[model samples]
Each structure stands twice: as C-alpha cells, then as structure tokens.
Target: MRKLTLLFSILLVSLVSAQTLQDSITFNPQQQLNAAQRILSGNYGKAVTVGAYGEVTYNQPEALNGELDIQRLVLLFGYKFNEKTQFVTEVEFEHVQEVFIEQAFVNYNVAPNVNLRGGLMLVPFGIINEFHEPTTFNGVERPSVDNVIVPTTWREIGFGVSGKLNNLSLGYQAYVFNGFQSTSFDGEGGVNGVLKGSNGLRSGRQKAIQSTIDSPTLSMKLDYYGISGLRLGLSGYFGDTQAEDDVEEIDGANIGISMIGLDARYAYQRFTARGQYVHGSLSGTEDYNNLTGKDLGSELQGWYLEAAYNLLPQEKTQRLFAFARYEQYDTHAGTDGALARNDAYNRNDLTTGLSYHLAPGVVLKGDYQFRDNAVSGGEVANRLNFGIGVWF
Candidate 1:
C-alpha cells in the first residue's frame, strides 16, 4: 500500500509539472488570484511550485496525549488553461493516514475587480478558516474559538466570486453552495445533541466529490485593510441544513442556520493584537431535538483575543515573541429536548506562550494552558505543550 501511494504521488507531481510547463513559463510572486491570471496568460516562467508544512508536538501528559505527529502534509498544484482561466488544487494528508482534496477550483478573470470560481473551495468565515497555513498564526495549535465557532478548515462544493477594491483596500467574497445532509446527523459515534460534537455543520461537508443539494447555503465575507498592518472584516453564513429529507414527523428537523462573525488584526512596531467573535443560531432546533432524540443547542457562540510582542525587535533573521490568548466557547448553549445544557458546555481557556522564529516559515513554540469549564472538576484538563512547525 505504501509503495503504491508513493508511486501515485510521484506520478501526480510529474503530471502537474509537465502540464504547467506546457501552459506557462513564469510564476509571478503575488496572491493566488494574481498568480492565476499570469499563469493563465502564459507570462510566467515557472511551471509549478511544490511545498509542504508539518507540525510536531509534545505534551506534559506523555502517556495518552503527548507524542510525535505529522498533523498535516499538503501538495499544492496550480495550472493555467488559457489567458483568462486557471486551476488550483490542494491535496492534503492528515495524520499521515487520511487523504483529502482540501481545495480544487478553477478561476476566471471576469473583470479588473471580479473573478469567478467554482468546485471545492474553502469557506471564508474567520481569520483561520481560509488562511490558516500554520505559519500564519502563533502558538502550537489554532485558537479554540475557531474550533467551535467559526470552525477552521471548513469547505464545501460551491460556486463563488471574489475581488478586491485595491484603491480602498477593501475585498469581498460571496458564494452559493450545497448544504449539509440530515443523514450525517445520526446519534451514534460519540456525536452529541441534535447536531454533532464535531460541528453539526462541518461534519456534513460533502467534500466536493459528491454533494447533496436539497438545501442550499449562502456565505459572504467583506474585509478591509486601509491602514498598514491593520485588518478588519465581517462575515456571514445562512442555510437550511436539514435538506428536507423524508422522515416521519421530522419536519421540524428541516431547520435553518444563521451565523455572523467579526474579526480584527493589527500590528504596530513590535507589538501585535488579534481578536474575533462569532455567534449563530439554528431555527426549529427545539422541535428537531425532540424528533431526533438528541440534545442540540439553538444558540452557539465563541470569541478570542490575543496579544504578542517581539523581544528581539531589531533582529532581522530571527525573532522571539511572548504571547498570551484568552478564549471562550459554548457548544451546547440553549440545548433543546429533555437533556439540559451541561455546565461543562461553556469553556474558557487562557494560554501563555513563547515562539521563536529560526527563519521565515520556521518556528518553535512552548506554552502552558489554564482551563476553566463550567462543569465541576473540569479544570483538570490543563497541560503544557511544546511544538515545532515549518513550511516552504
């Protein structure tokens, strides 16, 4: 199996490289969209670029939690079909065993300020959802708020448009796509509530290979960066998650989901700060819970704030930063049905860490976490973590 996988990977890389070389000659350094335009126009020199990233972690509780791991590895491919059209995709391996098509999309330059794209694409919800890239953020792991609220790494089979108002430093992305299936809403496999613990919305991702469209979802994002090193944005998502499936007296499960989020990032001198807030609700969840015999919440929320400063501000090749973050989230707020919301459902976490940069895209991190859960005795989950991450 391993040998076959290796052979397949080698063949895939060769195919992409050969195609890119035949279509384009150069690769201009810029954003994905701009690069797509140049590649499609046959103006770039490089046929393709290949890179990967990985993170390894060690924890205080070495027996069950602490171990070496390849959190993720990715192979990115970009190709130009013509002057106005291009294609890009990301094939990712998770935990070294699972493979997925993280992204696969085609782009068309419709105008100076607009581009249209379709296929499997990331959902732009918060800072980390679309631009995670590991090296882009601080700490060994992504923020907790992103996990339960905005839900990073969220993608779907969809069609969308994106463009920028360069003069105003404003950008926008909006899309319409197929939504979640009620079948992924079963009550087993450690899934809790009318939805799922892993995110009732995220678990149902059709992943682009095959998608169910009984329910359609709409998502939009508006971002601004008028000031140097300062960014602000707002995003929203709405959809009917249940897909109107045929289930006896389960009409109530055919519910609606609405979510809104706000995020900000700013940097000045050697100091930096970031924050994000998200809130959402599901309609008909109360009745839906009764019909499914699961405890699902109607209201969900998450938020986080972080600050960091470079200790070696004058160093050009290396940097040491001290950072702290606070996060809060509730996955079971306003749970419907007979099962009341567990106090432990609301969680607060504080993390303090030091990150040392050995070079651009290479970092080592150490952190200690303080945790507080509304449920009794939940504080025992605190631990210390150390990790290294790199990308090229």
Candidate 2:
C-alpha cells in the first residue's frame, strides 16, 4: 500500500509539472466534463432540459423460476438558471412502484475550475455510486462488491466543491454530508437498528428522507486521467452513524467508520480492464452490537477485477463485448467481542457474459454467475441473467 501511494504521488507531481509547462493552451469546460457532469450538462442556453434512462432485467437461479421486472427508470430534469448556476434533479422509479429522489442539487460555478454545490446528492464513494447510468456499465447487474460493500446509490444531503483541472487531467470532489442511521425506535418501543452483518452499512443509508444528523461525515474523491486510455480514482469517507433522538444518549447507539477505496479503468484498442478495492474499519462495534443485539462486523473488505474485449471492428456502429469478472467480499471480515464470524458472509462470484451494443444508448446483455460461500456443505445457487438497457 505504501508503494502504491508513493507511485501515485510521483505520478501526480509529474502531471502537475507537465501541466505547468503547457499553461498557454486554452481550456474548454465542455472537454473537462466527467461522466456525471456530461449527464447533467444541458443545452448551451438558459432553458429546461429533460432526459431519461431505464433498464429491464430477467434473472434465473439454478432450478428456480425466472423473474422479470423493470429494475429502474430514472427521469432527469435540469434548469440552467444561467451560465454560472444550474439546478439538476433525478427522479427514480424502482421495480415500477417505488419512487426515490436520487439527486437534487444546485451547482454554482465559482470559477472556471471550481464549483460550489449543495443539496441531496450522491456520495462519491466508488465508480458505480456516481456513474451508474444503465448504459454506462457492462453486465446485466452491477458488481457484488459495489452492491454490498460500497453500497452503490448511497446518498445524503450535503454541500461540496467539485471541479476539474484540465491541464493536469484531474478531477476532484470534497463534501460534508449527513451520515447513516445506526438505530431507530418504533412507536411501540421496538428496537429497529439498520446495521447488520449481512449488508454492512448498506441499510443505514438515510436517503435524506427526514433524516437525522447527530454526526456529519466527510467524503472525497480524486480522479486522474493524465495517462492516455486510463483513469484512476482514490476515495475516502469518515464519520459516525446517527441514532434517533430517543436513543441519543444510549451507549453503542452509533459507531465510527472510516473507509477507503481505489479503482482504475483502462481501455486500449479492442481491450478494456477495470478493478476496485474497498476496505472499511468500524469503532465501537462491540458496544453497538451488544446494545442493539445486531451482528455488525469490525472490518469490511471487497475487491474485483474485470477484463473485456470488443469483437466488432472499430468502424462498426454496433459492437459486441465479451467479458469476465471475479469478485470476493466479506461483511464479517472481523467480529467484535463475543461475536462469531459467519462464514456465509465470506462469499465469491465468477461471472462471464456478452454485451451487445445496438447503439450508443442501447444495449442487450446476458451473463451467468457461479456464486459460492466459505461455509462447508453450503448449498450455493448459480444464476443466469439477461437485460436490456437504454439511455437518451
């Protein structure tokens, strides 16, 4: 880890020095837009913009009946108040019934390379949490690590600064956000804590729905694209969970958390590769678990590597990609006092599939997964998945 840090520092310095020497070139804000920015960037005038994206999926477990559903449909609405300020929002419909305000934020361009943003926004944790448009990723479903460990689509009300350094090919984000909820109480005086061993901090996502903030969290992410055909990211999050007012003074009602993530993506000719690693440590878990009667782990870790090759020629409007990925994650990587680790929490998956892009904004996908766990004599179920994704 130290070596990796040193190498990143050296590369960053070299890029900065090179950029300093080329200060004469003009900077185009459009050229510097990242994936999220591109999605939010509307027409070049002061007007309202509308867009939508959605996915339909089918999944079949071995020896089980297949299920099909409209996984998600998101509508994007943005208004450019002026060149200097804009408001963007996304409304999501999950499973054709559940509704959510995925993001609703205002951005003010304070300078050519910096912007001040505020409102309910996505947490910049890893790749998928922010750039999760249906057409943006390969596979019928997202990586398991992203789903369980990093908790994709996690969001909270926050304020932050974000921008790009075009010359250095770097983009940066820093935010102060509301943290997760560790526990809550019911009207009937029942303990309803959200944190558990099965999904780590996933269930704690407050989603800004009349959420409480006894503690604030800090999140930051840096993206480097100085090297041709490659993109690298480093992310960090730190803070403590919140508890309902009723349990505000109770011991173990909240836990301190610190997490870090590293990810990279590379594309060269017909080949592409990507990987991510995430680790988190929890403080006061022992006491928290004892109080809530929950099985929360002290440590959580996960990682995955994927590679893909395009089978079609570059000139073709349509393309086909064959890909494979291997993933391993453990929500119970470490247990607290008197808590026994659950081997079922230690799991891995092997997935292979094909993605056919019929157009830039439309794709058909199919994949099979071999899922297993560390438990002896465990009955693991494999799955086959298919999906269609569209964006416009």
Candidate 3:
C-alpha cells in the first residue's frame, strides 16, 4: 500500500506538469512538443501502441460447466499523418477463433472545437458501447442490459463530426450499413434469440463480412459531459430490416426497425453511479410474423443501475472497490398475436462484486451474478465469476 501511494503521488505530479506543458503548447507549436510529440519525438509523427486483454470464468448452476478460455485479444494500430489527421484501427480475436475488425477510422482535427471522423466505428450510446475497455468498468461481466439493449462493441460503417465547446460535448454520426438479417432470428433461449426477442438483437449483426443490404440503416447519437462527474446521453437507430428483396411480403409489407436509448453517469468523491435505458420497436411485425411463422416480438426494452465506491481515500493507483448492480430486460417485451410473450424473454439480474486495481488500467475482478426469469421448468441462473483484465 505504501508503494502504491507513492506511485500515485508521482503520477499526479506528472499529470500536473503535463497539463502545464499543454497550456504552453498553443504559444509555440513549431518549437515545443504537444502531448503526442512528447511520446514519440523521433518517429516522424508516426506512432503505434498495442494492448491485449481477456477473461476466464467458471459457473456452477445446476449441471452447467466451468471453462477457462481466452475471451478477447486485440491490437490497436494508430498513425499520425500530421498535426490535424490520424488513422486508428482495432483488430480483435474473440474466443480465440473469431476474428473481427472492431474499429478502423481516420480522425481529422479540423479546428479547436470541431473534428471529422470516418470509416468503421463503434456507436456511442450507453457508457459501455464505446469505452468498454475491461479496466474502465466494474463487474467481471458487463451489464446484461448493455449487452442486450445498447449492444456493447456495436460498430458499423459510417462517418460523422464530433466537437466540444467548453463543458459541452456534441457528436453526430450517420452510418450507411447493412441492417439486421432476418435469417438469424430464432425462438431459442440463452443467447441465441438475437432476432427472436429471446436474447435481444445481437445475432442480427452482419459484421461487414459478405453482408447483404436491401435498405441501409441510419444511426445517430448525441451526448453531454458538461459537468464534472456527470454525463448524459441519447442515441437512436432507424432502418428497414429486410435483408432480402425476394422474401414473400404480405400486402407489400415489411418491417422498419427503430431503437432509442438514454443513459447517465455521476460520481461524487468516493461514490459513483451509472445507469442506462433502451427501448426498441419494430414495424409490420404482425404481417411479417404471419408470413414467416417466426414468433418475433415487436417491442424490446432493458435497463440497469450500478453504484460503487473506493476503499482508499484520495488514492488513484491501487485500491479495492465494492459494487452492486440491478438489471431488468426483455427482448420480447411484446408479441404480435396468438402467441404470448415468452416468459424467458424477461430477465432480472443482481450482481455484487469487488474490483482491485494494481494500476490504473490493470485489475482483478470477481463478482456473483443472480439471474431469474419466469420460464417454466427453467432453473434460475446464478453463478460466481472472477477474472483479470488490462489495458494500456
């Protein structure tokens, strides 16, 4: 603990010095180093940083299995073209077998207050949607509501402008990307119901791999961070979901999908709180259900609230923190007809955990998850999980 405190003091002092240097950069950019130049003085304005993190877990519920696996491995590549432009990309390996290009974009600092960014990018909605590096958030597993509603790691092909004025931050991104593919919809339970409203809208992702698009979608996000320790946001998505032109349509009817989200975060001293709510609606579901014979829900919604506190005071390096979270979500909030909404669609989650950080971006995680649903003959899924993650 003594060593940790000393390290934190040194870091704090360095940060103050850096801030002072930043204030001086504006007066003499041609002769002095900015934040980026200080890090790579002889690299010809080109620089790259790499990071990797993963999780291993065990679950004991009924006869469920325990497994140790590399959950996520990633490499981030960045290059500065000049003072105004840079290229960034993230190459990811999931479960060690799945490969994904999570992000690839070029950001241009057009002015002191405005910037333009383009290419495949992560959508900004809830807190986790964009800044979900493991060390940055609480809990061994991410909040279920974010996974099912806001859809963590959600990315698409598009471009937009991001800017800030004093305390207010604003961003606009419009993506022309393939909408959900209807083929992925199924009425299964436990993570398979991405389109069927049983597991939310996850499986519908096209991931830009030989994707098909009949009508592309437009997604937008607007957020604020105008106050210290407080953040507020709103985001939405709209598009036609029909992936095939030849699918049989009832009276020339098809479904257009829409989703809206609201989220907030606040912290005071040692106490921190965060929450998010997202709701989705589907159009022409009755006709589409009749034609496809798949029990698809027209409505989906989910929400979660979390709070945490640190055990050490005025310390930023190493400290243990306790947290608790409550989550409720239903991918199948409502159905078309004749079929009642599946009880399994609704889930209630309670989690309590402790996180200990050895460094700012490296930590050990442990948590217990208690999950309940109204499914007939289905046992409640409650388990304990622990893991470690890092970022730099």
Best by TM-score: 2
Count of clashes, each model? 8, 0, 0
Expressed as tens digits, the lDDT of each residue in 271-347 for candidate 3 is: 77888899989876676666556567888899999888888774455767799999999878877767578888788
lDDT values, one for every candidate: 0.70, 0.84, 0.67
- Steric clash pairs (candidate 1): 25-44, 25-45, 26-44, 26-45, 26-46, 27-45, 193-295, 194-296
What are the candidates' C-alpha RMSDs? Answer: 4.9, 11.1, 9.2
Top candidate, metric lDDT: 2
Model 3 residue 37 lDDT score: 25
Residue pair clashes in candidate 3: none
TM-score of each: 0.85, 0.90, 0.81
Candidate 1, residues 339-373, lDDT tens digits: the string is: 57767768888989998877766789998888787
Candidate 3, residue 212: the lDDT equals 57
Model 1: residue 7 alpha-carbon error in angstroms: 5.5
Residue 367 displacement in candidate 2 (angstroms): 0.3
